[model samples]
Every structure is written in structure tokens, then in C-alpha cells.
Target: MEFDVKGKVKEYYGGIARKVNNGSGKSCCSGTSCCNEVSKTSLIYNGESLTYLPKEALEASLGCANPVVFAKLKEGETVLDLGSGGGINVLMAAKHVGTTGKVYGLDMTDEMLNLANSNKAKMGVTNVDFLKGYIEDIPLKDELVDVIMSNCVINLSEDKERALSEAYRVLKEGGRLAIADIITLKEVSTELRAEANMWCGCLGGTLTIAEYKSILENVGFKDIEIEVAHIYTKSIIENTYLKDKDLDDVANKLNLDEVDGAFAGAYIKARK
Candidate 1:
């Protein structure tokens, strides 16, 4: 049997975008469950800067960490957000960049793209543009972006190396990479790696912190730094996905406990 990793990811995220558009469902793939609304709000976006945007935009967000917070966009700087689900980060970055700066939101799913555009219309944000494309192959011109940001998105790519390479290509001479993604703290087992559900839920396809650094270095990025923001505990893992025997499998493999951090939400920063 063949497992369609990319198809599963697209289907899962496309479903999320549609659900958000229809004002139903919640984010379940960001390590923290969006169905747990209170925790989702506090854990992801805690600032008041995004209050002016459409409520649905915030509700549609499926990010792990606030990359825009870590991005620290300056006015008049061009920014690009890969996999800009619902345009939360893109809109937020637009605010930080002011009117002079331009922000591009790239997503492969048409459903997500439509939802993002709908949110853009609701907010009347002129500086943001939602593009349709894959992270592995960005649609923008080369050496065009001053800052590149993504939130919990890069890890979903089946070919992470290509995705990172594309990220590096779009960045300007002194561009920065401020992204939030899931990084594994432990080695993944063969069984877990083959689990499509885990992959769709932000677990199966991931890299170690060291692997990220090495890839960035090879991609000609400098000043690389990665910090663990939130560790996905046994309870969190259980609550996030698979409420059945799958939980038992993950527990047995990771040997979950309070002290054992199997995976973490990390803030990765680098300069091109």
C-alpha cells in the first residue's frame, strides 16, 4: 500500500480551511488542539495587535507559535510567509511593515487561498497578497524578499530540504528567516514515521534542531538560532491526536513523562 503523504497533508489542511470558512471545526494539527479554544488563543497569539482583523482569520489560524512576534518586521521591508494559512501572519506582518512594505502569503491549497483572500477583504489590508504554490517551489521572483517567515508549516513538507532551499532562494541579500515549526527531540520510529495521521497532525515529518541548523548552513543562511518554545508532553500528545490505541503506541515509543520532551515547538532564526 502507498501512503500519499502530500495528499494527506493537503487534504487535512484544505479541510481545515473549508471548516474555518464555514465557521465550523478547529485547528488540531498545531501540537495544541484548537478545539481547546482558551489554550489555543493563549498558546499561539496572545497579543492585541491582530484585534482589528476578521475574527474568522484568527479562528482559522493553525500556527504553533507567533512567528510574526519573533520576526520583528521593520517598516518598509518586504516580507514573505510560506504556507500562510488564513493569512494571520501575513496580515500581522503587514501591520508591522506599514504601508510601504508588501507581504506575500504563499499556500498550495485553493481552499486556504480563498479563505485568506476573504479575510483580506474583510480587513481591507492592501499590503498583503496571497499566492498559490507549494513551499518546495515558491512562485515569487528570486532574491526578492527581505524577511521570510512561516508558522508550523515547514515541517509538513515531505521534502523539507527542498522547501528550505526555496525559502533561501526568495530571501534578499540580508534577509532573515524567522519561523516557528515542530522539531523532534527524539528519534522517530519506523512505525510512527509511516503513520499518515501523525504526519497530518504535525508529528511524523520533522527534523531535529541540529538538522535544521545544518540545512540552513548548507543553504547559505547565517546566524542560525533555534529555541524550543513549547514541549509536547504525553498529555498534550494524547490530547492533540488519536484518542485510542494510537496514543498507546506513541506513549510506548516515546516513553512519555513530564520530564521527557519528545518534541517541541521551536523558534528558528537565521540570516541570509
Candidate 2:
């Protein structure tokens, strides 16, 4: 039987949103959960930049890296954030675009959308809008956005090609794709691929940077580049992600060597 990759990812993120709503006072942990970015707001954002944003918005930012930094957003340009969580990036981008431009945050999970809307309200940014939708099938019309950005969310998509295609479709001619996400350096084992927990943790669906470039190119993107932020070494994987799981099963069958240097956080950029 095929694993329900989308189902697992949605459930995992939904749980995180519910936690924040319950006053857990914890940031959502998406990619590299607990290993790299959990509760480390300063690790992902600058202190001064976050001051005016909603406090809970900071708690709900579970992204692997900041994609807005890659966008080079211009005034009066519209932006769409795929899988926008907690509305932090949206709010920030709203400031970048000012009152003349708009930023749309698309999320499939209702809990996340609610939390994001709540954050939007707290921030009092009228230019920001949160929509309910999947990343693979964006809710916007074609050639409508000036920039497309996502933070650690596309890796969770069950259908990456379709997602990329939709991203291409929504982008105006020459629109940019500036995103921060997890990428693999090498192929993963079938055993590891079936690990539901790891998938929800943002490891299973990633493709190598080359694969990403190829897919983006095939989808009619140009000038593609991927900047590596950090590589997961052997010790980090073993000590962080590989702990507290059933070792007797197929997951144990994976060679630690195959896992090491296999994943990294990257800034993926391209033109549509």
C-alpha cells in the first residue's frame, strides 16, 4: 500500500497549529524539527525585524528558512506565499510591498489558516490575505503574482511536480520563485522512504538539488540556483532524527552513511 504522504504532513502541521492555539507557547517544528530550528526564532529571524509582528506569529513560524529574503520584493508588486503559516512572512512582505501591493498566504489546514488570520488581525496589515488551499493546486489565477515564495513547505507536498507546475502557472512571465526548503544530496533507501514519522518531520519527500533544478526547468523556469545553508552530518542525523524510533524495523535497515550529508537546507531560486 502507498503511504499517505499528504495526509501525514497535514496531520502533523495541523497538530502543531492546534498546539499553538492551546497556548503551548511553542513554535511549530516543520523541517529539521527539534534538530535545527525548533523554538529558535532568532535562528531564523532577526530580532529587530520581528518586533512589531504578532508574538504568536513568531511562535507559529516553523519554516526551515526565510524565503522573503530571497524575493527582493519591489514596491507595488504582488506576492504569494505557498503554505504560509502564522502569517509572519505575509505580514513582513506586506510591509515590503507597502499599502499599494498585496500579499496572499495560502494554506490547506484550517487550523493554520485560522491562526494565520488571527495573526493578520493582530498585525493590522490590511494588504495581507490568507486563503485556504493546497500547494500543488494553488487557488489563484494564472500569471497573477510577481513573486512566489515558500518556507520549507513544498517539501511536504505529496506531488511536487504538480506543485511546481501550479507555481509556474500562477507566476507572471518572468516572475521569480524564491524559496527556502529541505533538499537531499543523494538517493534515500526504500526503507527510510516508508517511515511515516520521518515524512511528517520533513525528510521523505525531498529531492536532490539537481532534481529540483530539472523539474523547475521542465516547468519553464530559468536561471535556477540553489544555495546550501547547512548540511546534516552523520552525527546530527543519528543523534537528532534517528533517535527514539523502532530500530528493529525497516528504518533500522538504513545505513547511517546513506543518511549523512544526504540532506540540507537550501535557498532555491528560479525565474518563470
Candidate 3:
């Protein structure tokens, strides 16, 4: 990734983290265009109580699926969560990994780290640690992690190859990478691709499924599987309007446009 692109993502998401962490009513899940149902449902499904996280942490959740559950993590193994926004999945992984194991939440935003740290305190969980860094260049030692998980974050990396390589480097032999994110089934229009807000919001910057797989393969990861679990076009169109009501009325009234070859959510599981 270019320095500017990386910096843009960091700044974009960092501002988002700051907004939601402050307990404002502003929605991070498209800020209004998308329905909150998915977020609410995912939280309940993931076993998060309303008391577990702050309002902003809850609001700022942008994950399309639960990577913690998809990862099949076990107790007493070290787990690392890339782009651990607001510590949602990090906290969940922490509980699942138990005190015998350690969970590391690596994120680039200082505000997000602070929010995640506060959530840790609120939950009384002492087994997790939040670190400041980019996922493309993880701060952990090579071959030290048992599992790597991320939620809708890697696609935004300016250098996804570096991110995947870092993921592989930080994992133990036979370690796995389980990610729940957005992926395109075909080519997306350049217009949509150029939207910085959409890109940062986990929409515009996504890779094609084949590209995602190829990158994992290039990084020496095997048994790569990318599954489409959720189709969020309806929700995205909904969010498009909800997040930015100013879009043309005709555009607003039109149903969510199928991103042609786009899948709302995808799960990628690979092994070192």
C-alpha cells in the first residue's frame, strides 16, 4: 500500500472510532443508510450483553460476520485480531480463549485502542491486550500466534500482500487465518471504487474473490476457503440512504443495487 492510502484508511477509521467511542447517537454502521438489525443481531448472536461495551463501541461495529465464531478458536491458544475495532470480537475471543490464553487486539487508531481498553475494563477481562499498529505490519514476533482473526478490515489495507505475509509470519506452523469481510464476486464499477467513504466503510476497497485467494496463496497459506455468508445489498442500499440521506431522491427510492459480482459478507479460512 502507498503511504498516502494507508494513512487515509487510518485517518478515516480513526475519526469514525472517535465519533462512536464518545457515546454519540451517530451510527457507524453506515451512520443511517443501513439498518441496525445486522449489528444488533450479530451482537446478540456473539453473546455480547448491552453492558459489555460502550454505546460507541456497539455503534461503531462494521463487521459483516463473526470471525471469532468462524475461526473455531480453542482455549489456551494465543489469538490475534487484526483491525480490532472497538474490541468487539477481541472481547469475545478473550472470553472464549479463557484466562489461560492471551488475546491481542491490534489496531491503528488511538481512539479505538482507548475504547477497546475501556471495554476491557468494563468487562473485567484481564487476559486481553490492545496494541497500536497497522495490520500490514503486525507488531508481533514471527510464528508466535496460534490463530489470526479479522473482521472486515484487511480489504482496506493499501498493501494487502504485506498484511497477509505479516499474518503468516506471526502465526505458528499450521496456524490459521480466519477473516470475515466484504468481497466482490466480479468487477465493481470505478465510480463506486473511488468513493473514499465507502472504501473506508468496508465497501469500496474490497478485492475480488479470486484476488483474495491468490493473495493468500502467494503468502504461503494453504487450504484457503472463501465462503459467502451474507448478501448485504439490501442493507447497503438501506445504509446508503440512512448514512447519507442527501443522495438524490430518485436514487434513494431505488432498491439497493446488486453490486453485480459483490457479496455482502465473506469468510476466508486459510492455514500456514
For candidate 1, the per-residue lDDT at 59 reads 68
Worst 10-residue lDDT window, candidate 3: 241-250
- Candidate 2 residue-wise lDDT, 1-272, digit = tens: 28788777778778778877887645433457542223356567652367787777777777777787778899999999999977878988999999999999999888889999988888778998999988888989999999999988888887788999999999999899999999998878888777776776667778888889889999899999999998878776666444422122434556778888989989999998
Q: What is the TM-score of each candidate against the true structure?
A: 0.88, 0.88, 0.84
What's the CA error at residue 128 for candidate 2, in Å? 0.7
Model 1 spans with C-alpha error above 4 angstroms: 27-39, 240-260
lDDT for predicted candidate 2 compared with the true structure: 0.81
Candidate 2 regions exceeding 4 Å error are 27-39, 238-257
**Number of clashes found in candidate 2:** 0
What RMSD, rounded to one decimal, does every model reach? 4.2, 4.3, 4.1
Once model 2 is optimally superposed onto the true structure by TM-score, how far is the C-alpha of residue 146 displaced, in angstroms? 0.2
- Over 4 Å off, model 3: 1-3, 27-56, 240-261
How does residue 115 of candidate 3 score in lDDT?
78
Clash list (residue pairs), candidate 2: none
